[model samples]
Target: MITVDFSRLTVSPGDRILDIGCGSGRHTCAAYRLKGVRVTGADLNPEDLKEARGRLTFHDQLGEHGGGAWNLSAADVTRLPFPDACFDLVVCSEVLEHIPDHDTAMGEIVRVLKPGKPLVVSVPRYLPERICWALSDEYFNANQGHVRIYRKSDLIARLERAGTRFLEHHYAHGIHAPYWWLKCFVGPTRTDSPAVNLYHRLLTWDIMKKPRITRFLDRLLNPVLGKSLVLYLIKRRL
Candidate 1:
């Protein structure tokens, strides 16, 4: 599922877009479908890169608006391989919390982005994430799992320190918070449980069908219990 809103980001044809830490390529796929932009998915995991590559054959399936080239690379966010100021847009969704030296990573993101271009960053919102931490230590301690919980203000302050101009922020995935709470209660790995399985089905259906009921409910609940906090930041011209 994509966290960053393309409309809010205002992606244009021919913009170069990068999705850093692009696990499984959900947002990468979204960026590729934007008409005429060039999209790249970079990740630390080869398997997820493979999944992204394999999924490209289906880009034609994304329809007329799906009109962009896709590139996949394995790279460290703190040490990106691209030349400076090359990308028009960069997405760092659900990634900062996983890095121990996120400040360095954020600096690298600013370096690669064109001056005045926006970087879309997202993390688990404080309250929902705090609940998850309270529910299970295993949740945050797993390998490659989240290492920090971010308050919105703290995250904004961090971006400012990284030399980006703060633009705006929003909450997302309100419907998924309860699903995670249920998982934490049962066991993070207990997908076999009936409740968890049923909720997964609901999420899958919502993704595929986009039925009105759940959409309405999710929009209504987003401000109160949203699972992710999304930030928009612009690189300052040197």
Candidate 2:
């Protein structure tokens, strides 16, 4: 499911977009669908990069990329391989909380993004994430799991210090927050719980069908209960 609202971000033909920590290519592929853009999906995991490449290739086979070019790279967010000021847009979703040196990653994101270009960064919202952490330790203790929980304002300030001007923020996945709370209560790894399974199915249906009722509820509840906090920012020129 897509989190960044494309309508809030401007895109022009020939713009180059980067999706850092682009697991499974969700946001990367979303950017690729824009007309005449060049999108790159970069991740630290070779396996994830492989999967992203496969998805991009599948999109090409289905003629769904809107004539855009795409590539996948195995790259660390803190030490990206691209030249400075290379990307017109950069997306770093659900990634910062996992890095111990997230400041460095933010710096790299600012460095690679063209001056005055936009960057979209997302992470689990503090309240919902705190609830999950309180409910279950395993939820945040897994390998490569989140190491920090950021209050919305703190994250915005941190990014601003890294040379990006915060524009606005939004919350997403309101309905999914309850599902995760339930999962944490039942044990994050417990896939056998019937309640968790049912919730999972409901989420799957919502993502696939996007029924009007769920959509309305999601939007209505997002400001308070959304699972993810997304921020929009623009890199500042030196």
Candidate 3:
């Protein structure tokens, strides 16, 4: 689901990009594959950074998985190590809600991105996230997991206040809302449960094969039931 929409974050060769909360390096890998853009994937957790580095261009076909041309850094989003205006693209997918200091993070994101370039911010949609929180204490109670939820408008308002002049916005991953609800209802960590296991298998199949039946269904249902809201913003040129 992410890969499809993420392709729109296009870049030319040598374009510098930053994956500020690059968990698992999915977006970072894709950027390398599509263009020879220099990318830095940064995260606060050393463990996630290590795992993300290992998967980057490791053992995949030569032409597959973004060609492994990326640098991984252990760093915090609120305080980036790089200088100002260092990247043409910045992506903070599924990471903002976890930070209690979202404003600081937003400031850093804008600071690093070259003015007029695009920033893609993705968060769990309000309704789907609320459902998960309502269903289970473990969802947000983990403390290490999501700390807050975001509405598209709320997020946009923050970016605007931070001086990021966004030009457009949209929602994505509508197919995932139910899968998470199922997990929350069954048990977020209890993938072993019969119902949970079945649902996981179905989701895996759906992503891999992308059957036409489900494709059309998701297109129809996404506006109402999408799991993630993707906000595409641009930093006004100085």
Task: Give model 2's TM-score versus the native structure.
Answer: 0.98
After TM-score superposition, what is the CA distance of residue 156 in candidate 1 from its true location, in Å?
0.8
Give me candidate 1's TM-score against the actual structure.
Answer: 0.96
Candidate 1 residue-wise lDDT, 113-187, digit = tens: 999899999999999999988997778865258989999999889888887899988899999999998888888
lDDT of 2 by residue, 71-163 (tens): 888899999999999999999999999999999999999999999999999999999999999999899975258899999989999999999
The per-prediction CA RMSD against the true structure, in angstroms, equals 1.4, 1.0, 2.1
Q: Where is the poorest 10-residue window by lDDT in model 2?
A: 137-146
Task: Report how far off residue 172 is in candidate 3 (Å).
Answer: 2.0
What ranges in model 1 sit over 4 Å off? 61-65
Who wins the TM-score comparison? 2
Question: Each model's TM-score, in the order given?
Answer: 0.96, 0.98, 0.91
**Rank by lDDT (best first):** 2, 1, 3
> Lowest summed lDDT over 10 consecutive residues: which window, candidate 3?
59-68
Among the numbered candidates, top lDDT falls to 2
Q: What ranges in model 2 sit over 4 Å off?
A: none
Q: How much is 81 displaced in model 1, in angstroms? A: 0.5
**Candidates ranked by TM-score, best first?**
2, 1, 3
